[model samples]
Target: MLDLRSVEIGYGIMDHARNQGYATETVGALIDWAFAFASVEQIHAECLVTNLPSISVLEKVGMRKTKEVDDRIKWILKRNSVNEA
Candidate 1:
């Protein structure tokens, strides 16, 4: 079963939006909102191995690589608790 306290995020924009900072900004905002308003403990994102742009966006939002499998990579960012980094 799917965990209600964790969620995965994904997005894509039109060709005209490529190279703009919208993706990074939006992802960062979403993560911040999730941690602040939702009861979530972690957020996850994944992209194809060939999709460097997607990987960079995830990194910029403080998500670190958690695993690599086949042609894709997984990333995760956990809510920083009072006693944890």
Candidate 2:
């Protein structure tokens, strides 16, 4: 099974490596890796309600908003829902 039970991506502008598509690339790779395992039925992500950028990234990677609890917005990428685009 895929080992990434949880994952988070962040931007570090101070290192001069920010906003260069790093976050998107990394998240895409992570998602691909997670799906590589046949036993991995789903992948999940969460972000604060105010984190627009994080929400955008999750959307770009084809994760759908499943639910919201408290201040967090939960997203889900289902293995069987590969048609999302």
Candidate 3:
């Protein structure tokens, strides 16, 4: 179970929309919504180690590496740690 103050986010983009910055924009918007409206204290995400595009999008949205478990890497973004777009 997740903590009440924390939320985990996940997203996927269509094959046709892969490299057009859609992932980054969607992730950022989600983060903004979570913190702004949900009153969440933190957000979390996980991506496969080989998924470089996903990793880049999480980092660009201000989530940092929190752990690594085999093939998956965990990330977290604390509230107030990012400037909303």
Candidate 4:
């Protein structure tokens, strides 16, 4: 089980998995799993602003860019938002 409130999602593709849809698929499933609990108001993830591929995956998984501090971009997936989709 994951504690959505405190959990941070991190993902990276190995050389063999690069250019494939595995990262997106895995993040999508994790988002679904994170939002499974009623107490999970939102899920958070962060990536370096320079990581365009990672940013793309987060966006594709329904996470919105909520904050940016220095080189990091923070994304959030709200439970209510996902439920409405």
Output the number of the lDDT-best candidate: 3
lDDT of 3 by residue, 1-85 (tens): 4688999999999899899999999998998799885668999999999999999999888899999999999998888777642
lDDT of 1 by residue, 13-80 (tens): 67899789999999988887878756888888889999989988887788888889999998888887
lDDT of 4 by residue, 1-85 (tens): 3363645688879988877899999998888786676676788899999999999898887889988999999888877788554
Worst 10 residues of 1 by lDDT: 76-85
Evaluation by TM-score, superior candidate among 3 and 4: 3
Using all chains and alpha carbons, the TM-scores for the candidates as numbered come to 0.85, 0.77, 0.91, 0.85
Lowest summed-lDDT stretch of 10 residues in model 2? 6-15
RMSDs, each prediction? 2.7, 4.0, 2.0, 3.1
Off by over 4 Å in 3: none
Query: Candidate 2 clashing pairs?
Result: none
User: lDDT per residue, candidate 2, 1-85, as tens digits?
Assistant: 2355444333322347655777677778887887787767778788889977778878888889988999999888887775656
Best by TM-score: 3
Cα lDDT listed for each candidate: 0.82, 0.73, 0.89, 0.82
Q: Please estimate how well model 1 matches the true structure, expressed as its whole-model Cα lDDT.
A: 0.82
Superposed by TM-score, candidate 1 places the C-alpha of residue 61 at a distance from the truth, in angstroms, of: 0.7
Clashes of each: 0, 0, 0, 0
Model 3 steric clash total: 0
For candidate 4, what is the TM-score?
0.85
